[model samples]
Target chain A: MCDLVVTENGSVVGTEKGRIYVKLHDEELTTFPSESLESITLMSNSTVTTYLIKQCLTKNIPILYITQNGKYLGGYRGVTTNKTSLQRAQCELFNTEFSLNFAKKIVTSKIKNQISLLYRHKSCDDVSTDIESMNNLKKRILFCDSIDAVRGYEGRAAAVYFKGLSRLSGEFAFDCRSRRPPLDPFNSMLCFGYSILYNLFYSLIETKGLNPFFGFCHADGDGHASLASDLMEEWRPLIVDSSVLSLIRKKMILKEQFTKAEDGGVYLNKDAIKTFRAYIQNKLFQKNHTVESVEEKKSYFDFISHQVSTLIRAILQKDFSLFE
Target chain B: MCDLVVTENGSVVGTEKGRIYVKLHDEELTTFPSESLESITLMSNSTVTTYLIKQCLTKNIPILYITQNGKYLGGYRGVTTNKTSLQRAQCELFNTEFSLNFAKKIVTSKIKNQISLLYRHKSCDDVSTDIESMNNLKKRILFCDSIDAVRGYEGRAAAVYFKGLSRLSGEFAFDCRSRRPPLDPFNSMLCFGYSILYNLFYSLIETKGLNPFFGFCHADGDGHASLASDLMEEWRPLIVDSSVLSLIRKKMILKEQFTKAEDGGVYLNKDAIKTFRAYIQNKLFQKNHTVESVEEKKSYFDFISHQVSTLIRAILQKDFSLFE
Candidate 1:
């Protein structure tokens, strides 16, 4: 009930005998026993079955499917045990005036994180223009009228911040935000990191019986992943961006490790992918103090789940201030 | 369990008292007691809530969500009351040689029906070429090396058949099989009909504890709806295509009852959508003979559920010929 049993790297398979078996080609490697295993993240080309998957599903143990290069493809889980109280509150407050206000809170928090990041890097000589632009956007969100306006300010702030990121010197040069086959080495790393963050938020949101497409900050639509997208907004700069920028600044991702496609799309070569995966995995184990409740150090994994609980509490109480 | 308790064409609200209160803009119109309701299909903008939805989920009573325009959006259901015998068999049989045989069976049946439809319309004298094309495709499927090849034949056959359908009548024209904002009225009707059929299959598959995405004909990718799509193939001509063609032939859908968009796409006008919904609902209640078990007459709704049970039986026996 407390911890995830992560089995990453190499091919893994499932069994009829209620255990997870890992392998490298034809060689049997290890088995994960089914006990106190809250979830399993498959980071390799793994084989599994409906029977074992159902066994995990019924117990509400999520099976997260990730690519070898650490892109989150999808997740599987059971019908959540009903928390009628929070579910009712979520349905009631959703798409109302209260939901709109909560969305504002989320965007405000996101802009705050962006401004804080700039404030931290302000001492750098060439960052004044970027910091000033972000600061202006943050101030505008205070008088924002619509969800579109909030999103407008957030978008503007990202443009300013990424400009600053590109100005950083090293192998991890930031370009424009390009995905759907990331066009550069830095963007490829950022995309993978954001996928993991989004998937983490998805698991957390659904455990509380909140519909992932129903959200305060995102437009409701089929297949939107709105709630997870909403929850990861503030954390994007704090977690994914910081990690990405650090990797670039430290020369962890090298130019030679990127491949150029005929169509001009750039991808992380295999060795580069291996290095990036290791860095992300290491980040999962690293602890940091929460910006809001600053005391004990907490892993990124723990902090994300706690964020979902805070969201649930916010929906139920009609107060979103806990989000900051 | 034999009959659905439907409350349609009104503004309805859910209550904690285990009954649905029908309302029309703040005026309480009627109420329906929740007993003997096998499922609830919301066919309007009518609102319902967590309390009654939770009540239905716990009892394994599925709640089908449909838009006013008769698009089947999604469904909510409980953890299936597991039949471990069938569940275990389904997993074991999936993706095996026997499952491949089942995929072959589905394609064979689908192609056969396409040929039959062409034959039935042979009085027109111009459909001979389409019939010959479909017959060749059907033969090619018998020698298909992979599921992709089988799917390739299926795709080709649809192209030939839709070409035939477009040639039937001037007003009942079809250009291509356009879904995702179906660009013509015929396509709009076809897409709506297909959605209903797919949703029906989804409910049946889940009731047998077989995962909808795990199937013989599918790649088993995330969110494929493979089983639903798989099961509905054999019935498409017998159901949706037949109903759509009949509506056009009967002049039930008029050309004036369609709208032209700025992008030159055609959509069913509101009144036309209402008419289409009625025809689909009526078809659901119309009795039809089963292709395999030809004894008792059954409604389309009953037949779809029976097909799932037959699939469960096939998985257990490892004899996919029953799928025929």
Candidate 2:
């Protein structure tokens, strides 16, 4: 059984054993018998004596020390000369691969589609405005932009993109609403697309050996890092945004297939969702060849991220690219 | 034995019969006589025709419609309807209570002390810089004094706050490296503080009727609503932030107790975390009486979000508050 231990101050200590201790000023506290304590997070500030340290070392307990603000201080093992190299190596592999995959997906095809989808709904006049804002956003990110500028414009850009994407998707699914209605195609597509992106990012992040909580782009907190969101940004247009457009334009699915509910909301019918899933799977794994002679087959997602990483590496190395 | 229908597309379809004919574009799609169809999604679009619909309705076979994008179209036998209502009701109740609780926490606390704790750090100047950024961030949030401002800044402001928070947190955690030999007392305090806030927010959000995704301040997407992050913001100063300041100012958790890891990281032993967790719990749940006779007995977290929401509601209603 998975046992979750939520301490008094909201520090959740999950372990197989249900036992936990509350330490006082200088005492070693345990609420239960000396059972196996699999995972213990020290969110307390009691004085650490050598005896207490030795006891933990003898017990071989893995302890995570975190600040009150949720900053991970580090983990404690009884042994001083632990194999840190293995941990670092594992983390490096995970981070590098994850970053590479993310970049491959973003630079080539995904970013273009995401940007296009975001701008798809804007009036002809507003297209430039959207483009301009995006360009500015890109510039800020590329220049290792001022922490201030990056911080300042991030939320606004996110809002514009989110609202724009939602509106465009809604429009694409409008015709299908009254006639076929089962679920809101737009919302479903968004959710499905996000889910896929999230799973991919989550897997990659987990593989990297880094605590997802310790992230660069997003904040650190209970809900921050949002590795899924960070990775999804580049792919949103290509996968979700384009998928919606294709479904609408192809007329493979019709509006009559959707159904409206009592809640004044819409959903897709079961058949429709099945069809959509097939389409997306095909899209993700679709092969593409960049050069005529190379004869290389790569997922559109993979190709895009690879390009993005190259661009990112260039930017980091101070070699300028159009991505900036 | 429960047998699932296997389809070419890898979706599972269930049927009472041993086998069923699935309409496909090319050949008459047929499957072996099995307990059920493993992949029901591969069933041709024609399977959902009027005759099939009527038959399904009469037989009470659970029918689910999905879009090509894997959006849940409605399902038959009232499963979708019931589930949707239950989910919605749950969301609404959780949102209201969470909001009320959070708001109450902020109004009754020592505001400056709370803010300082969230922003303070002892290990590096980078942490201090992060703390300083909070003042500007607060100003940015407060400057959006009206609903219009809130809406205008909603996207960018939230993003900036998230970014600032992440950066600040990263710095305080010493760039995700191990802490130094002389463990930063402020670091442990903040970490413990954050854990508490995270747990509190997690609980409140669980109770709220809102889909943590459908957040007002943050945009919507896989990572956007980050309800946990949103909730943590309000109590950053008082719980985690303030605890750090107090710990350092009073030297509750000493620097010597923090040991260096083989990886050159710093961390407090388990004893420290336990001690701090208790201290935080006491402070958060501490009750005080005010002359106004309003029950000031709410948890610190409850007070934080309440104040933030009150500010938001006042802004929405166009009533001015000092937070501006």
Candidate 3:
């Protein structure tokens, strides 16, 4: 009845018109496809005719014989090379189902953390430029509000201003005026944070047919961390920034935990590394002490990686809103 | 004299005050520990005291048993609780051996390439500046020679000026270009070139006990392609520049092979991809077709990866000339 049937024993059978018969001996049972309806007997030298097997083979049907105990015998069938096409079709169907399920899961997850970061340095003239850049990024994410507007005078000057502002914002995050040689806590956290995110992102990318190195936003270069960088961009504020701030505020990791080396470089110690790893794992798993059940808390990291992949799939299908 | 000696039949024969004896159904043989002996056997019913076994165990010596057919069986005396020390010692020994062999192979093979590169990139303006930069780079593999040298110069401008001068002076052979958006063929080639290098570098970093993401030359930040860029810096002249120049010179790929989309974005076509892949593989294998004899050539990609790892080992040992 079916185009092809794959049995639990990992055997494939194709059927057009054929019937299989079974017989039992003293302690053993055997099955065979035969044309004639004859009763099987013990101690009888029964033989299977080649004509019946040839008939099944020519008719594009395969009948595989199996004993009662699931011992496999051979089968007769026409040559089948269309299995690859059928397999590809099946794979696509599974992928679509997986994407839809992942999307639904993300939409319903309780892992939302929204934070706005603004760079307020002594040299910068306009603080609103930072706000404006954040607004533009938010708008791209489908958050449209009057506050999310970039109010600027000149196009060329604004472009240059924004470029400078972006570079300054990055520098501000890295500069530590309090410490000698400036231990960049923000960038350090980002390095570790992105590593974790990239690992998860790569797993999701592998699930999709796309190569991780062949990316959309990042230009390919020799040793370009294309996929890692691409995925980390959208998640910077939500994950890396939030994690660093929480760690510092909670006094889980202190400034003293960072050591200044002879080469004028500062790095986190083993204790700090252990603390950070535990903190990140907790954030990723969304484990909350206040929550009644673990299921009530959902990880934002997991949601983003899975949902972004689904969003990419939906975009390919011309469903842009899925990204929002 | 040994406390105990193994018999030929894989049985333990106890030596009584340095006098050992073998018992068989047909015959028996006795010998002193100082005397040369043939294959020996132990009777199954012979009553051998357990105190001897305990004495052997306390001494940390192995009990040996010999078969009638001249086979020997050995057993340790004491139990080993911890394997970490043994493993560490074994690893140290193995690494020493591997390093020595690798250094010999590389020195013999790569000295010519290194000399040629140095000669080709020789400049006149200030030999000390270039030498100083190269010396500094030798100290630390990841570096921005031109960026550190030229004041008030930005990204591609600094790279081009440095590379151009170096090429004119016969210090380098490849042309450097600014990476532009909407990807041109040169940029595309660079992109592909870097991706290949990145994958290979990551694989090597994984083999060595180092974090690929943590780098020296590249600044730490979110989505910074530090590890990939770090590995690529050393091999840029050898692999990427050479491949791109060869592709251009041979005319295996044309400018028309790159399609400029309606959106102004350019991408290489299928034919160009094939050509690029073939070129990359050829470079990776370092196959020489002109010479009649089959000479094995190490791929520049493989050489860079090995060079970095060897450098890391050398640093651990406080050996400075690993790069040299």
Model 2 misplaced regions, further than 4 Å: A1-113, A117-126, A140-148, A151-154, A158-184, A208-213, A221-225, A258-266, A289-294, A304-324, B1-324
- In order, the Cα lDDT scores of the candidates are 0.67, 0.42, 0.41
For A1-324, candidate 2 gives per-residue lDDT tens digits of 111122233222222243444444324344553364433444333222222233444454434443322233333333222222222222232224344333333332333454676566565224556666755665554443233344455545555555555455434533332212224656555555555455444333433322232233333233333444555566666776678667866886667766666765555565675566567757875775465556677776565455444533433443334332
DockQ, 0 to 1 scale, candidate 1: 0.02
Candidate 3 lDDT, A1-324, residue by residue in tens: 111111222221211245543222322232334343221111111222323333433343333332221122212212221122221222232224433333222322211112133332314445555455544443433221211121121223234333433344433334322233234554455455555555445434433433334333344442233444455554554665567666775778776676665756465665776677567656765734243444555566556656666555554554435554
lDDT accuracy of residue A241 in candidate 1:
73
**Among these predicted structures, which one has the highest lDDT?**
1
For candidate 2, give the lDDT.
0.42
User: Could you give candidate 2's per-residue lDDT for residues B11-86 as a string of tens digits?
Assistant: 2232235355444454545545543321222111233322332233333343433222122222322111112222
Q: How far is candidate 2 from the true structure (C-alpha RMSD, Å)?
A: 23.5
Q: What is the lDDT of residue B100 in candidate 3?
A: 40
The 10-residue segment with the lowest total lDDT in model 2 chain A:
A1-10
**What residue runs in model 3 are displaced by over 4 Å at the alpha carbon?**
A1-324, B1-158, B161-176, B180-183, B223-225, B261-263, B287-297, B318-324
lDDT digits (tens) for residues B1-324 of candidate 1? 322323344454455376655566778776667675566666654444434554565566666655544554455545334343443355466557776677778888987887787788777658988889899988888887777878899999989988887787567777688877778888878887888777677666765666565566765543455678888898888777877878888888887888876766667777787677678767886776455646767787776776788787778778877753
Each candidate's DockQ? 0.02, 0.01, 0.01
lDDT of 3 by residue, B1-324 (tens): 222223223233444665554444424444466233321222121322233333333333333222211111212112211122221221232224333433233322322233234445454333334434444333332222332321212232334334543344331233444243334566556665666555445434533433333343344332233444554654554666567656775777778787765655455676776677568757765634233353655455446656776656654554536543
Best by TM-score: 1
Q: After superposition, how far is residue A120 of candidate 3 from its true place, in Å?
A: 55
Fnat of candidate 3: 0.00
Kindly indicate the candidate among 1 and 2 with the higher TM-score: 1
Interface RMSD of each: 19.9, 26.5, 27.9
User: In terms of TM-score, how similar is model 2 to the real structure?
Assistant: 0.31
